[model samples]
Target: MTEPARDTIHCARFLPHPPAAVWRALTDPELHARWWAAGDVKPLVGHRFTLDMGSFGSQPCEVTAVEDERLLAYRFAERTLDTTLTWRLEPEGTGTRLFLTHSGFDLDSPMGRQAYEGMGRGWPHVLERLDAALGEAA
Candidate 1:
């Protein structure tokens, strides 16, 4: 059996907003629900959340850590497949760099491979949506 996809993937994007703005969107349940899923998602440390994407799939995540306007981490305690999620924001001159990573997937399995590809397509669109919100807010 292949090992799980631990810390093996990296996705990054630059959002045109200050770190504080991006951080709010990341850590606030309401703001996150707006762009992500309009459901229960509290981004506080130790809070558990479920990302229900209708019939697509549902992911259960637990907040792991938070550092002011810098980083947020979640462990995917339950999923259609195994994964850990995290978001890191670093302030640039006039904006923030956002990085999202999902780890611990068994890519050799069909389900795992499917999830891997799906996330690859999904994250960029989500980032684009966040970019628009940031742009309009600025």
Candidate 2:
């Protein structure tokens, strides 16, 4: 018997900002566009939106869970990628410890494998951009 694929990307970053600032960057469409894709993201569950992923085109997403400045989760890329992206925030000293989980990649398929590999390499840079964006605003 073969073991199930453990295909998930986990990233954590310590932002020198409060949880509220990090939360805003994750949910506010304008702020989000600066660090990542432009989307009508909100901290309310069931909100549906699309992120303009440049060459990757527009990717649909639906908010699945939220907890103020604590946590946010959404279905990402819908039919194509079919993954969930989750963010969690924790207060650490005078900063916020942010965690990200990108899950549900069907590694057996070519598209899934490619996305898994590509995104795995890409998320760190994205987080760095997030940090820089926050820094600029401060």
Candidate 3:
């Protein structure tokens, strides 16, 4: 018998900011901390980063991939379930199309279900915060 596979969650946004701008928000610790619940990040690939939002348990994560002005991916560990986050940017008419996929979550398991639901509820607000930050920076 094969092991059951984990369900994945995908969230996407079309931002009114350039891909470079979105890329900065995704990669820079200060820029990310302004929106996402992130802590000190080394700002370099293969480096460790931590995220603590005062409520969610502090997560020890790592930057796994980076492509200038296009993509950023990370592995977030130290949680009830381990996962990988991928951010992709495509240049659109005026700004960029930002896509996020948080894969490796088991929607069937209690913890995974909670994580999936909570992130689905909370990330939109976080994305809004990112928009405001981008506007301010513009």
State which candidate has the highest TM-score. 2
Model 1 earns a TM-score of 0.83
Q: Clashes in each model (backbone N, CA, C under 3 Å)?
A: 2, 0, 0
lDDT of 2: 0.95
lDDT for 98 in candidate 3 is 86
Q: Using lDDT as the measure, what is the rank order of every candidate, best first?
A: 2, 3, 1
Who is ahead in TM-score, 1 or 2? Answer: 2
Q: Worst lDDT window (10 residues) for model 1?
A: 34-43
Off by over 4 Å in 3: 1-6
TM-score of each: 0.83, 0.96, 0.86
Candidate 2 residue lDDT tens string, 1-138? 975348899999999999999999999899999999998998889999999999999999999999999999999999999999999999999999999999999999999999999999999999999999999888
Model 3: lowest-lDDT 10 consecutive positions: 2-11
Local lDDT at 37 for model 3: 70
- Give lDDT: candidate 2, residue 67: 95
Comparing 1 with 3 on lDDT, the higher-scoring candidate is 3
Alpha carbon lDDT at 65, candidate 3:
85
Between candidates 2 and 3, name the one with more favorable TM-score: 2
Give the per-residue lDDT digits (tens) of candidate 3, residues 72-101.
Answer: 788876466788888889999889988888
